[model samples]
Structure formats: structure tokens, C-alpha cells
Target: MKFFTCSVIMSVFLQVCSQNPLRYWTLLPNILVVEVNGSLGQQPLSCLGSPQEGTRKDDKSQGIIWRKNGVVEEQRGNSYLVQLEESLGGGNYTCHREDGSLVNHTVVLIQEDQTERRKILVKTDQEDYLTCLAQNYNGEFHCSWTWNRNRVGKVALIQVGRISNDSDAQCSVDVSTQRWTCSSGQSNFSCSVDEHGHRISCRDEQHCPYAEEIQQIYVTLYVRTEQFLVENYSKQFYLAEIVKPDMVRISEVNTSMIEWSYPSSWSSPYSYFPLTFQISQFRRGCKGCDNPCTESKPAKTLMVHFTDVCQFKVKHKAKAVCVRAKDALCNSQWSEWSHLRLRRNNKNKHRQNDKQG
Candidate 1:
């Protein structure tokens, strides 16, 4: 019975593939996918509707017509040019010969500019684990994101560019490994999705630290699952702006004081990539507490010099303590707070009181 079900499923899959029109067209070698973009008057859409290559022996005798949104716009031309504002320029553009046979069809999507799609990069608490990080101005960076719980998806496409419209870029995937590779005029890189297809990691080849302010990395990821669901997520950022340091670890050095050190993964020689420490005291029971960092009236904020182990006396009689850190220079984002439990030693307290007496 199982074998029969498997065979029936395979037959249905092949039948669906045969019914798809683009399936066979995409297999043809040397097929051209023409793309164009334009603004109001600065850029106009002048596109050729015929194949650039291959001989058209009857072209001289046949007349061509171009139409935008099913309305005839041009009567004769090998290439059609639109000299209108971009807002009035987008439509289903088609080309035909005098014989009333369709020669080509192209979809013109008009936009103010390419960066319009970059507004989706805002961070939110619901975001699972989507993050893009780079330590230096070097051309190498990594982007990783996770999906909502119980939702599974695989990366079907990856696009990267400085502008939004330059998305003609392509990425090749390794099915066995789920890794992706893409290259552009100014960037070259590869990425890999995890086994569950919820996480991605990328490396940039042409990244450079020069002109950091003017440079930005724009990324778009298309994900699809077995249920035929598709989604696109996009983000844009500069390397330095998103460089988040890992959480600092705090440990008790003595009864009177606690010490903390930088995360092991942070940039080397601590002198350069220093981090500031923010210590917040929390009692066993607190009402309407703000975030651990801001819970106290005035957080005990201290600047820890690079390359130094930070030590601060725990003067508060609070039951618990929380410590977090952030980059000293940019102060971009804070790391996760580390919690410590205080074990009050009454013997030591008595000894200090006796000495005072």
C-alpha cells in the first residue's frame, strides 16, 4: 500500500511540472530576461521587445506595435522608449507584430528609487534571531535570521545590492548543504542556511572599510516551504552600526565585591573595542520593574577601560544583581544581563562591626 501511494505522489508531481509554462521556457539555453528601471524625467524606459540575438529574417517586412496596459503606445519601432513620468509609466507592456502575434511581454514596476524596500529592517521583540554583524570595515560580514516557532521555510532566493531595484542578482544553492552564493558589481559573497532552513549566514567578498558612511549592505531573502508558502524579508545596514558585543560574564571574586570580564568573542586587544558596564541591583521581590538595566533609580553605570577586568563593590543590600555591557564608542546596543545571587555572610558582617566598635 505504501509503495502504491509513493508512486501516485510522484506521478502527480510530474503532471504539475508538465503543466507549468515557464518550466520549459526556463530550461532553454541563452534565454534573456530583460529588466529596466526609470524615474519621472531623469530615466525613461526604452526597452527592445525582440531577442537581441538570433536572426529575424522577416523583420524588414513585418511591422511592430508596442502597447502599455493593453493601450497602443507605439506603432513602429525595434525598440520602444517611454518619455513619461515614472508614476504614469508602470503597466503590463507587450509587443506584437502586424500579424497580431505576441512577440514579447514584460512587466514594468515603477518606483521612486531602489532603497524603497529597505524599510523592513527594523528590529522587534518578536523577531526570532535575525541579526547582521561585522566587526570591522572589512568586506566580510555575516547575516543570520530565524523564523517564528513552528514555522519552517527554506531559502529559495537571496538578493544583495546597494539599491533596491538592482535585485536582478541571483544566488546558487547547494541542496545538500543549503548554502547560497551571489555576486554583484560591487559585492561578492556566499551564505548558508541551517539544517532546519530557519537560520542563514553570509560572507561578503568585496567589503572595505573606506567610505563607511556612504556604504550600506542591502539584503533580501525569499523563503518557501513544502506547503507552497513564500515570504520575503529584507534588511539594510552599515557594518559598524550593527556590531553587537556578546554579554559580559560576572563572577564573585570575594564576599565584598564582584568582578566581570569582556566576552571571549569580542574584538581583540580590548583597548580598541572597549565596552561600558551597567550594573543594576534587583531585590527578591520588586513591583513594576523596568528592564534590568533601568530598574534602579539611577543605574550604577561605569566605563571599564579596555583590557581591564572590571571590579565594583556591591554596596547595595539587594538580594540579586544584574550586569550588562555595551560598546563604549558607538553605544549601539546592550548585551544580555548576567544575574548573580548574593550569599550574605553574617560572620563577616559581625567582624566588621566589632572592628568599628
Candidate 2:
């Protein structure tokens, strides 16, 4: 009789898979993520029990109790069938023994509707849902995302590690600090979510500025909506690629001399992570003087400064002076131009005109 029951269960499982085809992943320890196509109708979720219970998910128990999103529900056997409609059909399903001891839990997520359905989060202007940046190479970075107008959600999980060696990475969270930590052989990272749930900040404690980085960091954030719909957004980058130096402070020592320093957030020893500076001085009546001009503007400048001590000398006073910096050692992005508008005094103006005459 038991053999006959196993055969019937196998037949039904294969039949379900054949229709919609299922893909699942173990998001955390016993937390499973099941992806299904909403248009495909119903899908079956098997109770993958704990390691000690049995190896196969189809193993028999002393009867099972089912619950949907923490509330008990009537579900027979070891499998619970869920419809494949959008949020209406999605939920967190768990099965326990008749004694109420837990077995396993699965969170069902519907894929972007192939025909007419939409995803939980919309793409941003940059064409991606996630964006990350680093102020320096101190093994720290922050990633942010835009929430969909109607389907706001929270981060369900975060995974970060070096490329090709992240399979064993483990992540845990601290309730008190609301911070998360992911540790692996190569590095240890701590991350925290912002109050608005739109941004996450992370830091690597063991990062070395001098060490050669042959590997890249890969990060994935799993976000879920109130309806139990989850989506994962991932990004891979090297520290140098996303390194954006802070604005340089340009101070006027004298009319002819302008002095500036490295951004305080930059990595130290200035020589090791040197920066290249560009100084531009705009003349009066220039049409583009209203905004910060890029290097393409009609400006005369040279990449001269490569240390913490940055200074530029002006032969004549002009409308404004702008300064920007970029990583001298790497082909990275330049910082925003720091502009200082110059106002010529009438006395100095008369003196200059007399000298010119």
C-alpha cells in the first residue's frame, strides 16, 4: 500500500513540473524561494523537511499541519498547492508535524508576468534597479534603489562576497544595531539598511588598500513586497570602478594663488592613491559660466597636481575658478567640480586697467 502511494505522488509531482516547470533556491537555512509563472495556473510546494527528518522531501510524516503566512490552514498530505496568479496567489507556506513542530517553509514568488503582468520594482533612469558607489577604497560601499510607486517593499535578504568564492559565504543580522554581516574566506562585510528602506550601506573590515585585488565583489539584494512577492537585484563591481572622490575644497590664498586639498574621505598616504586635479578659470561674459563646465569646455588647464597638496596660480583674475579630481592611478570617474566665483574690486580693476594701458 505504501509503495502504491509513493508511485501516485511521484506521478503527480512530475505532472506538475511538466506543465509549468519549477525553479527553486534555498535562500537561507530552511527558507526556500520558489519561482513560478503566473500564467501557468497552480503549482505544488513540497515540504522539504529538516536534515534529521529525512533526505527526500517526499518522506512520510505522522501527518502534517499547514500554514499560510503564519496562520493555520487546511492542507492535506505533505504538499500544498498554490495558484499561479500574481500577488493573489503568492504566500509563505510552511508545514509542520501534527505535534506542531516545524518541518520546512517556502516563499512563493511570481515571475514578471510574461503576457501582461508587471514586476514589483520598476527600472530606474540609469536602466537598472540598483546602483552602488564607493567614496574610497576602504572596502566600504552604499547601494540604493528606487521603489515602485504602488508596490513598496523591504529587503528580504542580502548576499555579498568575492567572485568565484562566495558559495560558502554566510550572512547574519543584529537586531539591536539593525546591521547585517556577511563573512567569507576573503573578506568580512557589515551592512545596514536606511530608515526609508531605499538604501543600504556596507563596509568590509579586512579590506587592504595596498593588496592587489584580483577578485571583484558581487552583491545581491532580495526584496519583498507586502504581498509576499520577492525579487533579487544584483550588481558586480571592483572598488576602483565605482570610486567617486568627494569634492575638493578650493580656497583663495591670494588673487594669484588658489590652494586646495585632497578630499577628506579619500584613502590616506595621498601618494599611494594619488589624485589628478584640473583647474579651470572662467572669464566674464562666457555663456557657459552659469554652470560647472566639463573638461570639454574652452578652458586652458593641465593635469599637474598628483598629491594632497594641490595649488593653482592665476595670471589674471577672472569670473570663476573650478577644481575637480580623479584617481590618478586608475581610470575612474572624476569628482564634481568645486567652483569659486571671483568678484573683482573696483580698486583692483582700475589698477589692472592702468597696468594694461
Candidate 3:
């Protein structure tokens, strides 16, 4: 009995450590991943400015070079300081030696922070409800929201209850481990917040679907800022209706052949968790066309089974292609499309053949 208890405790400890945010933060490379709000500001990213890994003292004397999206970047320092103009601060930045050898590479994926201004205008009210989404049909869902303008806060507590007047249950959070656990009736809930306090993700430990009219899960969130202002938000949802698969990533693009894989975050076992796919093709239009949206046409629709990769043979004239997937058997919602531009390689192949001869 004592041995069994020890083994169980060790398993729990390992699970908690695996989900620890501090560990994740440390693992992140010197890449400064930021969301740009069209503001000129300095991001104190020492990681980008720091001398390249394995860079010797002699190499530093030779000076370092920086490039943005393959174009040479101005300004010399351990860090790359620039105005966050949409055209300027976004894209892949690489530091190289004066000899043109690669040193370090940092990719800055800048998403538009559209909520910056609206957040300042809108005030947090008691009537405000959190928005939730289930990326896949089974297991979990994520909830995120912007706090009242000018208020920085942390999630103080989380509560769960059934929509059917069941007793309210509480979730305990381990700040160091960054895990939340709760037990409400027969369902067990686990949740985690991101490095930023805006998003929260929860999983149902006992989620099993049975034929029924409808079912709902209720979640409550309590947030507290440094000023001690406590505000709570609640939301109720049915997983089936809200299940939206994430955009499938296009992995391989070849002549008339496009291949993709399921999102890694999806629930396991492709045979059991089947997903239907949708493909769209965008052909080249008249030069200087005003709108390309009117030129898109449905390409193909298929299902992913037995294998993780989905391949489609499209027409040779196709210029661009897109693919998306959703729950195959269930009446769940479809996923946003994953897009790719096809660069025909017939000329390059013929050139290679001539060179070989």
C-alpha cells in the first residue's frame, strides 16, 4: 500500500513539473515574440542583442551584422532597436558575422493588436462574459478576455458548476506549477493560464459524449489587480456546438500535390477522432485586378483517416491553395482554412536536367 501511494505521488509531481511555466519561460530562445499595436517602443530584448552563441571574443572584434527578412538592417548593438512600424519591425531577423556567416536568427511574428484602443474606451462591467472556444471536440476548451482598461490583474480563482443547478465547485491553483484542479460531481477539471493573464484553458477530465438533447458546462473566473479590485466573469457552453478545429498547417507544396498534417494539439487517435477536410483554390486573375476574393473557388473536400498527412492532387494551373478540417462524424463547426501559395517548379526541373547533361 505504501509503495502504491509513493508511485502515485511521484506521478502527480512529474505531471505538475511538466506543466510548469517557469520551465517553459526558461526554454524559450532569445527570440522576442511581440504583438505590435502600431506604436514605436523599445523592447528590451537582450536575447536578440546578446553576442551569438559560440561567438568568441575575437569574433566580436570583427563586428556583427543584422538583417531583416534577408535585407541588411541598420543600427549596431547587441539588440536590434527599431520603430514598430508595421512594415519595419516585423519578419525574420538574423545576426551574422562580418564574414557573412550566420550567427543567430530571431523570428518576430507580429500580430495586429487591434484591442489596444478599444480596451482604453471600454470599461469592465459586471455583465461582461468571457469568450470560450474548443479547438477540438474532446477534452478541453480555452477562454480569454481583455480586462477593464488600464487594469493589470491576475486570475485569483476559478469556479465550475453545472448548468442544471448543481453545486458550485472550486478549482485550486498552484502558482509555482501553474496548474488548476477541480472536482464537481463526477467531472474533474484542470486549467492553466498563459504567461499573459488574459487567457485561460481548461480540460474536462471525465468528458464522454452520450446521445442526449444538450449539455452545458459553466465556468467562473475571478480576477484581482494590484489595486485590490476584484472582478468576476462567468460563461456557459456546450462543447459540441463550440468545437472548431484549428487551421490545418500546409506542410508540403509540390506540383499539383499538396500535403498537410492534423494540428498537433488535437485529441489523439486519428481513427477515433476523424476530421473532414475542405480545400480551396485561388487561380491567377487579370493583372492588377481590384479584388481577388471574387476569384476563389472550391477545390476539393476529403477526410483524413489512417494517416496524419492529407494529400490532394490539384490542377497544374493552380496558383494558390487552401485547406481546412473539422470533426468528421459530429455536427461540429469547421476550422479556418490553412493557405499556401504554389510556386510551379517545372522550369527549374528542366534547367536542372540540362545542367546535369
Q: Give all TM-scores, in the order shown.
A: 0.54, 0.77, 0.52
Better of 2 and 3 by TM-score: 2
Q: Point out the higher-scoring one by lDDT: 1 or 3.
A: 3
| Candidate 1, lDDT over the whole model | 0.57
- Kindly list the per-residue Cα lDDT of model 2 for residues 1-357, writing each as its tens digit: 999999999988667655552565667664556666543446666675443343354346437777888899876556667766533566778888877888777776554433444466677888987888899988899999988888898888888888864465798877643578899887788899999989999987888888987888888988888887778888998999989899998787776778888999999989888998887766643455456555335346667756756777864746567888899888988999887765444558789999999
Tens digit per residue, CA lDDT, model 3, 119-236: 2112335334576789865768888777665867677667764565556565576846367787867578888888887887888877764334255788887665543233456778
- Sorting all predicted structures by lDDT, with the top scorer first, yields 2, 3, 1
Worst 10 residues of 3 by lDDT: 19-28
The lDDT for every candidate, in the order shown, is: 0.57, 0.75, 0.62
User: Over 4 Å off in model 3, which ranges?
Assistant: 1-128, 175-178, 209-214, 251-254, 285-309, 345-357
C-alpha RMSD of each candidate structure in angstroms: 16.0, 6.1, 23.1
lDDT tens readout by residue for model 1, 1-357:
999999999998665533321111110122211112222232122234243421253354236677876788844555555433423344556777777777766554332333333232233465623577664444555677655444455665677655434544555656564777777665677777766565566767666444445657777876544332334577888666777667778887777788888888776567766777778765453456655445555334444454687887876665557787777878476777777766665556788999999
Per-residue error (Å), model 1, residue 233 = 2.4
- The full ranking of all candidates by TM-score, starting with the best, is 2, 1, 3
